[model samples]
Target: MTDTTSTETAVRTGLFIGGEPRQTDETLTIVDPAKPGVIVGEAASASKQDVADAIAAADAAFPAWSALSATERATLMAEAIAGIADERDTDAAVLSQENGKIRFEGFIDALVFEIRWNLALMLADEVDTGKTLPVVPGIPVTTEVSYQPLGVVTVIVPFNWPIAILAAALPHALLAGNTAIVKPPPSAPLATTRIVQRVAEKLPPGVLNVVTGRDENMAELIQSPDVAKVCFTGSVNGGKRIMEMAAKTLTRVTLELGGNDAAVFLEDAVIDDVHLDRLFAAIYDSTGQICMNAKRVYVHRSRMDELVAGLEARLNRVVLGYGLDEGTTMGPLHQPAQKAFVEDIIQEAKDAGADVREYGTLPGGDLAGGNFLRPALVVDPDPSLRVVTQEQFGPVIPILPFDTEEEAVAAANDTWSGLCGSVWTADVEAAQRVGSQLVCGYVWVNDHGATRLDLRAPFGGMKQSGIGREQGIEGIRAFQDTRSIATIDPEALAAMAH
Candidate 1:
């Protein structure tokens, strides 16, 4: 569990290419998000040349890696999973420093990646590569559908849940027989860097690679011809740029982008103190930075007051401090820019004559230098207000009242971003009826974000929220292409005639 890099690493913290660390002339200092004045470590600020090298390495390894049998790949994935387990504590430490989340959250994220990797590897053998066609009306031939991997997959990831999200795509990509060049988020690259270093060493050279850099280098990853497919998790604008660039090469792309997920409470929702904590955690956990966090809350008019009060009481209890502090349940926003963005949204709602309430107190001793903001709750805000209509993506929840189920559904589906929605009601059948009306990818009847996912179910977004899905068979197949193989033999045809 001892990580030397935690102490301002010795030299050579750079790109891990072809199973080796390659130093670069320029480097970026990773800062502790909770206390910006503190330095975590330095990583190579990869340039275009560095990106090209990584892509070349991935391209070189693609053939053999892709040619590996499913069992072989699964064996390697299991090895990589073991390697990751040994460094879980160290990696979680580094992740906590830059991610500005509690150690528990970082550890959970590390374990999340592990679970996902195992899921993909376990599902590897079950992936149906070839399926027989039963009779194609009037076609006197035996036909089979084959699933093949796209070559090199370039994964562009964001700071939030980098390891888990990368696992969502990269492990499955490898399971489908493809190499990967990963661009770890510059702001919080150390933990993932350590992960890839160990994983790459366990696998063949170029099978897995990691690079850290700015936007221009990401552009290189997108436009490179070596990449046959792309998986990106970031802002909507960034996803668009990746799509536009990948289009030049006709590379397949899967993007998990921004989401303004909504939560609804029917008249019979369990709003008692026992379940109120769950309701608040759904909205405020991860400082409300999660892509699918409950950004909008629509409650029945009778229960709106109770929901707001419960959320406010819960927020007031959150202890904001350094991520490493044991008392800290909620941590600061990832960056100053994000703090300002959330502040602006609160201000916009205020300008529109909405009553906004902020709770919690920042630590004056250790975390005063961090990008910390108390939770904000906008009550009865204007429906069109930015805080209500747009995705604030911070610790701000705006509760609006609905007179009827139809009105609640309309208000919930009114937003342009439809990633996820949850309906809270005691009546299972009633919740189902309301959930069915929601225009989102994943609809929860009684629960919100509790980290338990039914892997068989597809999860993603609708509208401008994102494209494509993650988790389940549908997700694994996104990295592959289908080919139809047909054969017509005179002998076989004669037998069929008989």
Candidate 2:
């Protein structure tokens, strides 16, 4: 039980814990990346003890929540989805204010779609009863396999897509009958907490909770022993550290880590002016903040010049600014460290003999107070440069020209991460063949980043991207413990003994 009235400020801000709003004196200032002096709002910073208390509350309520029939749980989850839908515009506005994404084209629609899709995923499979089996010449035996929830799920959402990452873990956890504790990324905490508060009100006490804080203190909340499972979305290094910490209690983890995805453009691919424009959008959308962002492009040496020219022209037109501004195409990186890191990568790539050509420009000088790094394009003199190999999570595109189809495949699969990739070709058969050859969890053919992710399909990485799947039936199964039940009737046992 929470005091909803206490958490609501004049700004309509609140934290949800145990199905109600919670307030605290500890303040976390939300910063807008584009405008340095513009403070979005202040969010309550939850202490380690607050996190622990939430976990304990979840633990206390787990038995009742997890024992609910699947249908019953799904019904509640449906209502939660409707609640989220009702608050869509409000959620999008705050998300844009905090994270600096263009609300209309980028964050708003995607967040709504992600939540809606997750809800559809929740209702994909119904509760199945035990199947009747023949027992010893016409007698019937019963065997059953049904999904069960883990006790309490703790979802740690990253800054890039606060609502989407929360949706990735929240709906599934609740529909599978698990209580949840959501810790939004520090930079954009208020928007996510507000979203959680809205949805949590419709749930039972202890069924949902939201906490906000700085990065160093965030780990303490995640590694707490009271949490039964954790679903984290962030960088690979951060995911590794979380895994190490979670090892103390052997908490079940679903980590959606970073990616160095390859977009292979084959010789047979037809790249007209229109398709090239769309391809550039696919690569640089959200200022290349997505984990599946196309960091590297492999085009046939024959068409390298054409591809570069087309990409350069289209990228030059992106309108960059704060998310609140109308017609803003690109937004600033949400934090100072991110801007610094991207700038470093761009400079390093140039230093390594790559031809650096930037489409967008940062108006403020370095150390400009706000985090802003514009879109950059790099044409590598040496195809095997570090810029082409590493995962630079920014709007920096590296174009590498390859000679043969085998070479293109080799270049794409050479990365240590295998999260997602794309292949563009007019020859459907060749494109399919190349896509199959790429070592990635998702392969988009003839396009990029538009591959449909069905809820029934398992979602995860093959190599260093991460371990285990998070969505689909496998996701629900990930939250369960299986036991093999064996029994023999007295007559069958006696016959076996004789």
Candidate 3:
């Protein structure tokens, strides 16, 4: 329910509650991250009452929406996908304003990664019914397995990769017969809200809803009696809070939280354009805000200097500015708070005697006031340093050289965040061997991120990275519960008992 009549102005937005655009007197102003002083727009500041209404709407719609055939559900998503293409340029611009980077890449990834994952989940209906195993013989007794949607689903999207994260929760929930309420991160809600508005308009009223508000609204949604499942993507601490709150209602939860993923380059690894380019992209993409980003680089002593030189040389070409700028390859951190957090980590690493080689130069004008920073590459930081041990979630990474296989494996696995990682080597066997030792959900051999994501593979973090999974059969199943049915013949049962 966006105002299509005016495209030039700061398009004031409202909460998409109960399938309609509902507004409140209190609204939060969103400013362009690239243009700090310029206002992007104002979005509804959803109060607790708004959240309760959204949950009620979703609860009311679940019975009918989830009862629809898989084909019908799939059609709704297909329509949304087509709408995405039509508004790609506009959404990209809006996305650029709300967040400093990833509008283009995020949009493309939604099409490539999101839609692909959506299609896989669409097949979940058939898979759930058609793929069940035959019951063992029990003299005329038959047993069947089936999947049922988990009613109302609450999706909390992170600001970093909003569209892609939405795809993970919303579409699957709808296609599997569940209704959903989405809470877009306020920091970068404009573009994400635009995308949600498109989907909400296409789908039946109450099937999908989006809200913008403070943290309390989310807690309310998670603890709502009607919400059956909650899918969240953000910080580990945030996930923990959600879990603790949801426990009261015993609502199901899936968390895709933070990561301190390491990229290990073997002694014989190729340091040429192919590997180095992908490696750099893995760490720098989204300004290193991605959950699966390579936060630590472990290289063999033999090739440490070469890798550093290559990374620094590539860093020279990076331009930090507005997302839409053709020459701008990097962008500012969306949140001002993140700037201080990242700075503290880097400064702490430096204090620990780490050799920090920083790159890129901040420019003036609109970019000067923006949250810009030269991406840092710290060398030989103490293993216990914050930069080395915790998830940076910013454009700063640490590189350390390892002497042996045991040292490299120990160093890579020495973290609570086990989201993902990579192993670089000429020998596939060698890479495979080492990748097996890394305690992560997925370990790439030569590259990283969405480029390496197998469409049907399950995506989730291991250990403290959080529980459950997203994507693949498991992903669709998360939105569903199973039922076992059996038909027993009385005569057969009596005969068997005799």
Q: Provide backbone clash counts, one per model.
A: 0, 0, 1
Give me the displacement of residue 247 in model 1, in angstroms: 1.6
The runs of at least 3 residues in candidate 3 whose Cα sits more than 4 Å from the true structure, single-residue gaps closed, are: 1-8, 109-114, 121-127, 130-141
Best by TM-score: 1
Model 1 lDDT, residue 155, Cα: 85
Report, for every candidate in turn, its global Cα lDDT versus the true structure.
0.82, 0.72, 0.81
How close is every model to the real structure, measured as TM-score? Answer: 0.95, 0.90, 0.94
Better of 2 and 3 by TM-score: 3
For candidate 1, write residues 1-498 as lDDT tens digits: 127425354323578888888877888888877876887887888888888888899889988988888778999879877857877877877888888877888888888888888888878776645788865535667788988888888887889888877888878888888899888898888788777777877889999998887776667688777788888888888788888998898887888888887888999999888677777877887788888788888999999888888887888788988777678888899989999999999999888889999888877875676889888899999888888877787889899999899999988998888788899999989988999999988888777763645555677888887888877678878888898988886666776688
Of the candidates numbered 1 and 3, which has the greater lDDT value? 1
What is every candidate's alpha-carbon RMSD to the true fold?
2.3, 3.8, 2.4
lDDT of 2 by residue, 210-234 (tens): 8776666566556777777888888
Q: Which 10-residue window in model 1 sums to the lowest lDDT?
A: 4-13
Residues 313-395, model 3: lDDT tens digits = 88988888777776788888888889889989988887877898888889788677788888989987778889988889899
Question: Which one is best on lDDT?
Answer: 1
Give the lDDT ranking, best first: 1, 3, 2
Q: Please report how far candidate 1 places residue 83 from its true position, in Å.
A: 3.7
